[model samples]
Target chain A: MMSLRSFRDPVLVALSLVALWQVLHHIAGDSAITAPAPTLTHLWEMIGQARFLPHLRETGLAFLQALAIACGGGILIGVVLGGHRLTGEVAEPILVGLYSVPKITLYPVILLLFGLGMPAKVAFGALHGIIPVVLFTMNAVRNVNRTYLRTGRTMRLAPMQTAWFILIPATLPEIFTGLRIGFSLTLLGTMLGELFASQRGLGFLLMTAIELNDVKTILAIAVLISAFAVLCNAALLAVDTRLHRGAAPETSGK
Target chain B: MKKATWIRTVFLVGALGALEVACRSGAIPATMVTAPSAMVTTLVKTMQSDEIGGHIEQTLSAVAIAMALSITGGFAIGFILNWFPVLRRAFAPFLAAYYAIPHFAFYPLLIVIFGLGSTPLIVLATLFAMVAMIVATMTGLDRVPRVLLKTARIHRLSLLDEIWRVRLPAAAPHLLSGLKLAVAYSFIGVIAGEFILSTSGIGHEIAFAYDNFDNPRMYALILFVLAIVTAFNMTVYAYERRLMRRRGI
Candidate 1:
């Protein structure tokens, strides 16, 4: 059974958030924002609409493709750089610099190259999500216990076997953390991509709502996206914590 | 210079040279991307024309205000939260989930509430940037050595003095990193908001140029933004390294 103490904080946070929303709604008036209750009702209505499915499908497809590229490309780059010390050192600063740059500025360039479509959206999403995964995986690989490598060598394992059997398992926990962070960033990037110069998707809907001064639709969409993001992040965070905890004792024992 | 730095410099230069070659040779169409040299010349010419000065000033000032607000306000809020375990516990999940929420989604809502001007942008940017500082402050405070607190207590220092003398110095590194992130996020929030919808700013100009098929001007503006941000970050990073070195960390 879940403990009361553990449940209490989230409830309190949720109530306070609702309270803040209500206050803001009152202050901003009906034209600027709908009350929380009305917004929730509007969101339900939105979910049931025939047109909503296509936009949902578009966003979901783009997000999944972006996630695939981000995870795969990030892990591959991470493995390559991490396995080679000099390369990792050379690339580290460059990666960090790229991470901080407001990549939104590059959207025009991306559009010019990829054109206005799924490719552009997926590319933008992957670009945001890839860096943290690389950074985390690189560190995890670098920190792999020397004894494990020695054991692999002693067993006369091939390089590929060593990587698969030894390296991946050892770094999985930290790498999972990277993936969790990457998941959120990729979603953010994809949504940002759709926000500008897109004809369909939730972001496009949001833009349309903004132009039409449709406060209810805007809030409903924002709430919907934020809910999805938070719920997914919470799940990933739970798995991430468990993995890290599971790894701790093994390292200490070693 | 160090070997890695040397190699990195060469690598960067080579990449730029390759891009220049491609652009000049029609391998990459001018419609797609302007040459690196052409981007530089256009940027220089744009600066000389001074037409974009107002846009630059608008973006930079908004970023500056957002950074200032987030840094100071975040530190204060973080300090209070750290002092209250109950509050911290309640807020922890929200804090953890904060960045995932696609904050730009609220830009239109903010515009509606605050009306069309820099207010909404500043508020949005501040909200976006402040959490980094708050998280950093909490972490920095949490990691301050127990022995330092003991020393402070033994000296009979007041709470304010204890925090100022012992806590702040000990937490300076994390705070500095937080400062770096705040600056970056502020720029991101402001530029992205302006890019999405704004009457005047560098981001708006870039979007305007993009729509008009002014590839040269668009690339030049992009180049300018990237250069300034990179330079600013490098300065902060250098300062952080110097501080770390002095502290023998």
Candidate 2:
């Protein structure tokens, strides 16, 4: 009964969201917001179109490249900073400040540096994502139980061996959580990059639709992006939960 | 006062000095970035002309309105949700995943519904910001000590009085954090909306300047926005620290 209730609640919420969309459609009229059903249909049609695929591919490639840089650079920097106490202290506030700033303001500066193409988009996306990853990973590394490090030392483990066997497992859960957030923000940054001064991508499509006042297309594209973001986030969230849960017992025993 | 703060300040100043040198020496092209001092000079010049006063006023007012709406509305919704466990459960996943959505996608739809001008910008900022407050409110309320409520009951305090005196004080830290997030998100939302497609605002001015290759003006405006936000956030951070110190946390 408890499980049933849990399952039912989300379904109910989903239904209500659709109902709200329908009601909004009624109020705003066809020109403003397309109904949910038609928007979904439009999304399907968009997915089937050949021209849409290139934009998707463009966005996908940019996102992947950005994610790589963010994750790799963030982890490397985080590890170095975390391992050094003073460096972490000096960098922490700056990173937090950067995290809060509306990075969209810096988009033009990025464009100026990287030029108006894939490089700008990737750089923007990475800029959005890398901070949180570094912050989280730094904290994760700093919080790793001292005993584990001592144990590795007592066993005469090499630095690489200790990192691989002790550090990675301990910090993996928190680091993964950072990755999940970074993933979302990177997508947002990429889309924003495409929205302005760009010729191709999902964001460009949305921008064009806005300019044309093509309500159906705008709704369709939004729905598509939202669906993708939500699904990927959900998947990441599941893994995050599992990793944290798995880590709980080990941490508690210490 | 602290060692870290002194070091950070020196580091920042040094970095700025290096950039200034780079810009002045033509190692870094003026087309890419103006010197920090040049940006400040341009900002002062622009301010003296009063050309950007209206734009600044429009953007700040919209952000203020959005921040107010987000805080009040989010607290109300969160308070109500806290009362109903089932509703809160339903909302949990959605709230968790909320930031993942590219909310700017809805800007056009908002422009359609609310029409152009600051109305849509305020609405977008409000929507963008409200969720953070809601989450914070719920967490704050959830952490209010059970013993305080029991004491309120023992005193036979009125519901409003109990909330105001005991619950609110207990939850103040989380609420303050929520306020900080709401402020930041509001700025982001309004500025980003204006940057994307608005007629007037600091954001629009930056975009316009960028388009026209008015590098100094663009850098000045960006610098002004960043300076304002950083100062505001630092003030909040200082307040939070004072609060924590008073509580011996």
TM-score of candidate 2 chain A against the true chain A: 0.94
DockQ each candidate and list the results: 0.71, 0.67
How well is each residue in A22-48 modelled by candidate 1, as lDDT tens digits? 999889889887899999999999999
Q: Tens-digit lDDT track for model 1 on B1-249?
A: 788888898999999999999999999999999999999999999999977999999999999999999999999988888989888877866776787787876777788788889999999999999998998999999989899999999999999999999999999998987898898899989999999889899999999999999999999999999999999999999998898899887
Candidate 1, Cα interface RMSD: 1.3
Indicate the worst ten consecutive residues by lDDT in candidate 2 chain A.
Answer: A2-11
Tens digits of lDDT, candidate 2, A82-128: 88988999999999899888898999999999999899999999999
lDDT for position B229 in model 1: 91
